[model samples]
Target: MKTADPALQAMLRERNLRIIMPIASILAALGLWEFLVWYNDVPHYLIPAPSLIAKTLIQDWATLAQSAWFTVKLTLLSLSLAIAGGVLLGMLFALSRTVEISLFPFAVILQVTPVVAIAPLILIYVESTFWALLICAWIVAFFPILSNTAIGLRSADHNLRDMFRLYQATPWQRLRYLLIPSALPYFMAALKIAGGLALIGAVVAEFVAGTAGQNTGLASRILESSFRNEIPRMFAALFLVSVLGIIIFLTTSWLSRAVLGHWHESEIKREL
Candidate 1:
C-alpha cells in the first residue's frame, strides 16, 4: 500500500483546525456567558442566558418564523432590484463618460444621505407600505454595487484593452472577453457588502414603517416585544436578525468562491 503524503496530511489538519477553532471558541464563549449569568442570578429581563434565549426562540417560533419569512422576502426583493438597477447603471456609466459625469454625483449623494432621514419621506409618499420599505432597502444596497461594478469595468488591463483594440475587437467581444471577467471580482465583493446592507435596510425600513400586524417582519416583532417589556422575546428576534445576516454573508461568500476560486487571486487558496 502506498503511504499518504505528510504534506497532504498536514494541509488537511490545517483545514480542519480552521473550521474547529471558530466553533470551539463560540461554544466556549456561550458557556462562559451562561455560567456568569447563572452565578450572578441575573434577571432574564436584563440579560437572558443563551439557554433562555433558545427556549424563547422555540416558544415563539410560530410567530417569529412568519416574521422571519416576511423579512427574508423584503430583503431578497430589494436586493434583486438593487442588483438590476446598479449593474445596468454601472454598465451605462462604463460605456459613457458623459453619463458617468452626470449621474455618479447623484449616486454619491444618495449614498451619503442617511437612509433613516429619507425613509420617513419615502413611507409618506409611497401608497404601498411594502413598496416603500423595498425602496428604502434598495437605496441602501444600490451604491456599493454601482461603484464596484463601474470601477471593475474600468479596471480591465490596459495592455489587454490595447490588444483588443489593435485586433479591432467588436464592442461585445471586448465586453465579454475582457471587461466582464475583470468586473466579476469587484461585483462579487460588492455583493457580500450589499447583502448585509440589504438586510439592515429592510430591518430599518420595518422599524420606520412600524406596521403592526400578522404580516409584519422581525423588526416589528422586536418593536412589539420591546413595547411589552418582553426582553427574552426581543433577544430572540434580535438573534434571528443576526443569524439572517450571517446566512447572507455566507451565501455571498460561497458564490464568490464558486465563481472565482479557480482564477481570482482573492478567492484562490495558496498552499504554504
Candidate 2:
C-alpha cells in the first residue's frame, strides 16, 4: 500500500485527536461525578458514586456475568433465527409477486404488533420460557431483515435481469450469482438496525416473562437490583447492557464492511 502523504497523515491524526478528546471529557465528567457525590455526602442508595459502582460491579461480578451471558445468548439465537426465517421468506416474496401480495399483509401485521403484547400470549401457549423469549425477540427483529432483503432481491439492475433471462439462468443460479450479492447491502443495513432491536426485544421479553430460573437474563438482574435498591448494582448491569449494545453495533458494522465494502454504497469507505 502507498504511504499516506505527510499532510494527510497529520489531518488523520487530528481527526483521531478530536475523537479522543470526547472520551477524555467523559472520564472527566465521571471524575466530577465522583467528587460531587462525595461533596454532597449523597447516599449510595440514592445515587451511587462512580467508585462504588465500580466496586459493586466487581462484588457482584459473578451473577452479573451470568445474567449478561444469558442475555447475549438470547440475542444471538434470536438474531440468527430472524435472519434465517426472514431471508427465506423474503426470497419467496421476491421471486413471486403473487406470494408477495398475498403474504406481505401478514408480515406487516406481525411487524406492527407490539412484542410486549405478544409476550403474554406466547408465555401462555409456549411451554418453555426459552422458546417464548426466542419467539418474542424473533418477532421484533425479523421485520427489518425481511423488508430490506425483499427490496434488495428486487433491486437488481434491469439490464442484469435481462441478461440472466437471456442466459436462461436457473432460479438457484440467479439466487447464488445475482440476488444474494445484490441483497447483501440491504441485509447488512437491516442487520445493523435489527442488532439493537434484538437486544431490546430479549430484555423486554424477559421483563414481561419474569425470567423464571431457566430463562434468567439481564432484565431479571436489573429488576432484582432495582427492587432491592442496589443502585450500584443496577448501574453495573446498565453498563454491561451499554457495552453489549456497543459490541453488537461494532460487530455488525465490521461485518457489513467486510461483506460489502468492496462494492456497495452503503458500506463503502470514502476517501478523505
Candidate 3:
C-alpha cells in the first residue's frame, strides 16, 4: 500500500493533539488533586478530592438533577427568545438605516450594562420569579445576537444588492435570496456566545433572587451547599455547571458545523 502523504500525516498528528492533549491535561490535573488530598489528609470540608466530589454527585443525584433541569429550562428559554427577537430586530434594522441609527444606541446601552447590577432591581419589580430570571437571562443573551446579525446583514454583498435593485427585487426576495445566507455564519457565531451567556445570566439571577425549595435552580443548590458547609456538594453543583457549559458549547459548535461545513471556509476542512 502507498504511504500517506506527509501533509496528511501532519494533519493527523495535529488532530490527535487537539483531541488527546485536553483529555490528558484534565486527567493529570485530577490525579494531582486526588493525590494532594490523600497525601495532605485534608478534610472534605476544606478541599474535597475529585473522587469525593464524584461520590457526592452520585449520592445527591435526585436534588442535583432537579436543579439541573430547572437551569436547563432557563438557559434554553432565554436563548430561544434571544434568537427570535434578535433575528427579527436585525432584519428590520438592516432594511431601515434611519430606524437602525435611532434604536441601535439603546441596544448598545443594554449590552454594556451589567446584568448583576440590574438583576436585583428587575427582581424587585418583575412580580414573578420565573419571568424575572428569564428577563435577566434574555438581557444577557440578546445583544450578541442582535449585533452579530445586524453586522452580518450589513455585510451582505453590495454588488448583489445593486443587481437585485436593478432587477427590482422585493425586500423579501432580497432577504431570502441574498442576505440571509450571508448573515447565517454571524448568527451562528452569536448563538454559540449567547448560549453560555444565557446560562451565566440565569445562574446569576438565581443567586440574586435567592429563592429556595422546589422552584430553585443549580445556583440555589450551590448557595445551600455553601451555607451548610457541604463543600463536596458545592463542588458537585459547580461540576454540573461546567458540564452544562461544555454541552452548550459542543451543541452550538456542532450546529455551526452542520449548517456551514459544506460551503463556508471556516467550517470546511483546513489544509494546515
For residues 1-272, what per-residue lDDT tens digits would candidate 3 score against the true structure? 99999988988999999999999999999999999999999999999999999999999999999999999999999999999999999988988999899999999888899999999999889898989999999999999999999999989888998999999999889989989999999999999999999999999999998854467889999999998999999999999999999999999999999999999988999654
* Leading candidate by TM-score: 1
**Roughly what TM-score does model 1 have, to 2 decimal places?**
0.96
- Winner of 1 and 3 under TM-score: 1
TM-score of 2: 0.93
Winner on lDDT between 2 and 3 is 3
Residue pairs with colliding backbones in model 2 are: none
Candidate 3 Cα misplacement greater than 4 A, ranges: 1-14
Model 1 lDDT per residue over 165-263, tens place: 999999999999999999999999999999999999999989988964458899999999999989999999999999999999999999999999999
Better of 1 and 3 by lDDT: 1
Q: Rank the candidates by lDDT, best first.
A: 1, 3, 2
TM-score per candidate, chains pooled: 0.96, 0.93, 0.93
Tens-place lDDT per residue, model 2, 1-272, is: 99989988988898999899989999999999999999999999999999999998999989999999999999999999999999999999998999999999998999999999989999999998988999999999999999999999999998998999999999899999998988888899999999999999999999999847754888898888888888889999998988999999999999998998888787665767
Q: Candidate 3, which ten residues in sequence have the lowest lDDT sum?
A: 208-217
lDDT for model 1, on a 0 to 1 scale? 0.95
